[model samples]
Target: MKNTYKVNNPATGEFISEIEMNTKEEINLALKKGHNAFRKWSQVNAHERSDLLKKWMDNIQAHKAEIAELMTRENGKPIKESLGEVDYASSYIAWYAEEAKRTYGRTIPSHNESKRIVVTKQPVGLVAAITPWNFPAAMMTRKAAPALAAGCTFIVKPAEDTPLTTIRLIELAHEVGIPVDAIQYVIGEGKEIGEIFTNSEFVRKITFTGSTPVGKTLLKNSSDTIKHVTMELGGHAPLIIAEDADLDFAVSQTIASKFRNAGQTCVCANRILVHENVMDEFANKLTTEVTKLKVGNGLEEGVDIGPIINEKGYTKIIAQVNDAISKGAEVLVGNEYNANHQINTYFVYPTVLKNVQLDMKITQEETFGPVAPLISFKELEEAIEIANSTPYGLAAYFFTNNYKTGIFLHERLNFGIVGWNDGAPSAAHVPFGGMKESGLGREGGTEGIEPYLETKYLSIGDL
Candidate 1:
């Protein structure tokens, strides 16, 4: 509806810049250009494509500081975290550059006497992505790098709240000799642009990262064209603490997992499942650490927590906190919602809730804010049951010193990723996705590029 997208610093609610929204006509033209580019681009040798991607990766590192600052301003993440994200984003490019050369094909022995069968991978054609604002830079490259490396042209519609980071990354790609039309972006109302992307016959595949409801809409829209789709949807991750776990190590890892990006990440610990035996100690240590975190503008020095993305996010977080409190959850730290605690309209206090019930909204829904709800469990089986209670099976974490317990949890967690005695488990080299409603396809690792490619079976008769 709006003709311009106004970018702002979410931390201070300051205006940054305004970008013109792309119209349906313009989007269609870009789609045609992307389709035309894909014809020649897909024919290029994998090694050449790899070289260009490596150049792109180098450019990202060279301008890391500038890009990191831009990301922080738009996404409201701490500057330190933004810098880490920049590195994480670039790693995808670097990895896919090398992985481009390894799209290996295999030969199968034919059952027929004189026939040979071979299977080969090829680019899936024009790919369209819709990325969210949480990890702006990283999410984009995670999809783009692999698509480009696989020789598919990409066009993305980034989240309206955080388009600047995506725009800057695409500029870097162009600077490194990447074809403008081969990798492009569109900024506008998501519904309109997304509809165009899904309806267009030229777009052969669609990759999306956002809420489950939206992912379902896209999935339904793309069905008419029967396009290949990759959905990295919502996650309600649970971090379990076993009775025999190292208390100090568990506390530190929980801090790293729960508080990073002010607890806005999809894989961030949503529920803290602590063993009842050590609940008081874990709760006390976690509360002390949370109190020490400084909440302010992300650009300011020594600030650990930043503002929530917008007023809606702030409201949702507050509502969840209230629901938990009313339902008998004890506040271990940060339940104050007064002007004295909040630096701005969108700044939420880093909160930790103990005795959190499974029925509370905070435990059931994905709270994308600076809040951690702790739920106590009596046994390993009960913990597993509680963790698997949600429909989302994206990522689960547990800290256990026992070999048997660790192995059992790992096998029974039913998530795409399981962190054992580790809080931050994601890396560019491993497959990242979720099970069930969490997501539909993998990103990163060798599997990351597979969604961008299609396999062809060749049978040579009388060979």
Candidate 2:
């Protein structure tokens, strides 16, 4: 109901700017414009679309510094991380620009001598996306690039906490000779805007990256229209450390995976499973590395950990840590929250817990903060079992020197992505999504554009 949406620097709690909220009438008009634009945009040759996307990608790269600063301010990520995200985000557009030319269809052999069958992929029409705040720029480009490359008009409602980055990206698109109506962004209450997207007949496809519960609601809402939907939902990623794993390598990889974005990522190592043979060494080394991390304003030089998104995130992280402590998890390092810290109230110290039981809240829930809980397992099978216990199956990582063991874990892990010895597995060229309750569909690689395309079969008689 509010007319203006306030943007703030989560790291420093500084007022940034206010964005005008789109009214329902304006949103409806935009939808009409998007639909109309889709009719023409979808008719354009793939090569032209690819050129436009490449131009947009170049523009984003040219303004990388400005966008990264805005992203760090609004999204509460370190400036260096924000810059990396801009590169990651632009990579999608670059990839899709080339992939646009490769939307090849198939010609199926017909049983009947007089008939020929052909299959073609076409744009699914107007697409609506609701992206998360964690990786604001990357999430948008990951979805939008493929959709746009597939010749679908796009409209997005970015997370309220971080809309500026999305808005700026859209602006870059428009400046690069891309039509405004062909790609647009709306700012407002998520529920209200999302309902309009789900309920609208003109929106042929809906893509979202958020929580499982919200993805379910959107699935239900879009059922009436039977809209094509792609949901990249929640993840409770597991990182397993086998007995034969290189201790130093595993520790470094864990730090890269767990503490990136202050552990606010969907694929952050939520449950760390370590073999009993190396549990103490792993825990001690992990604790030492965590303690060495610099937590402060994201804009500050050499600051590795930044403030949590807001009070809700801050409270949730505290609750999860406290619950683990109450259930007999021993704090190896950083159980103390300095309430009197002058930097920011939402700042959570990087935490590590040893002797973490499987029943603890930290293991069951996605700890979206910089907290690592070490759970010891005696055997490889036990570690596998513990890692696969959760309902979420987005990503799983394991470190092992044995080739056979690595192959075994890779095949057995019930996740969309499996990292044999690596921590970060996501990229512009790999399919990324989750299984089970983690949500549906894939993004990136050759599979990324599939969701935005509709397959049509044609039969020619008397050929």
Candidate 3:
């Protein structure tokens, strides 16, 4: 049966769109198409692929407003954040477009002058790029843009909750003459879609962004056939505020990092560790700012944030909040859902929590909500220890004016990406990914495409 999946409006728990699921035969057909396309597509010159990426960026720009709105509709992020995600995603196209031509090959001198050695990078054939719902379009493009830039044919399966925007992106690419199945999209539940991608012999690479447990599962599956896998998994990020940190800046940034997208981000600051010297001021300022954030429907103007994605995410967030309270955590600003308060009928309150313990359910696990736990530390050593305590080593943020402390923390933190004396926008030109459970493989700049490609060595016997 060709079952359909519906995208639900989180605030109202109403269906937004119904997407058709590809059947087993259809999945096989897509794999066949990808296999056929990869041979021809990967054989094309790098410059040609770069040119198409440029065109794709332009196409995305042309439909920026519509695409961003659809993202907001599906994921319930503020329109501004959605638009920012689109702009950021466009930059990925531009980045990989330039990277495609700049770093492709190498030549190593042999022991004898008569012999020469050459090493060149080649695409990994068909890649199945699976993306998560939060920052849906950007995640897909981050995975697909690099694979395509590396000359690989892609079958993109975006999260079921937010596939419309990305499906349209594939359609846009087709409009720009990238070919019909060169970048196909499968819109269905993870189980069905992933089975096809992992089990198919023709699909050689799997590029994914999602939870760590799921990443582990996929990694195991890919290993069964020895297929290449690039996974961007979950993170429980920690933000530390040193004793000398600017309390105002620390508070504002903490709220922003923790609650952005209603706290659905995998890299969101899950723990806030503040030195005891600044705890009172930090907590006060943070709660004040969190209190002022205008949480409403994404389509409305001036709304700083929006609802959690789907009723399941919404319920999960509420459950975490209630559990936090029952376990001795106190609400600083928001603790209840204002269900009667949706404009497009999709909205949630920005939440803040204090007096949270390290063993609390919300503290240990990812609540993926607007909840921010205000934790206190007495010493720099303790702060660093607490930050690295979590198994996830994705991204960690720290605020400190002391240069020595900043340098020490930067070197000591276990996270893959570290933000110095501030929150997690390290840079766009730099690489992004984690070290441990967070994920494997980079996602930006020159390093992004390295995961989607392989290098081959050739030697000339008698030059």
Error of 1 at 363 (Å): 1.0
Cα lDDT, model 1, residue 14 = 74
Could you give candidate 1's per-residue lDDT for residues 296-406 as a string of tens digits? 889999989887887777788999999999999988889655332243337788999998998899989999888999999999999999999999999999999999999
Shift in Å, residue 335, candidate 2: 1.8
- Residue-level error in angstroms, candidate 1, position 305: 0.6
Of the two candidates 2 and 3, the one with more favorable TM-score, higher being better, is 2
TM-score: model 2 vs. ground truth? 0.98
The per-candidate count of clashes, in order, stands at 0, 0, 0
lDDT of 3 by residue, 74-180 (tens): 88788999899899888888889888887568889799989999998898899997888888888888878888899899998888778888988898999998977
Root-mean-square deviation of each candidate, in angstroms? Answer: 1.7, 1.5, 2.0
* TM-score computed on alpha carbons, candidate 1: 0.98
Q: Write the per-residue lDDT of candidate 2 for residues 1-463, one digit (tens) a residue.
A: 6599678887776888998999998999999999999989998899999999999999999999999999999988999999999999999999999999999999999999999999999999999999999999999999999999999999999999999999999999999899999999998998999999999878999999999999999999999999999999889999999989999999999999999999999998999999988999999889888889998878889999988888888888899999988999888998766442344358889999988998788899988999999999988788888888888999899999999999999888899988878998889999999999888999999999999999999999987
Pairs that collide in candidate 2 are none
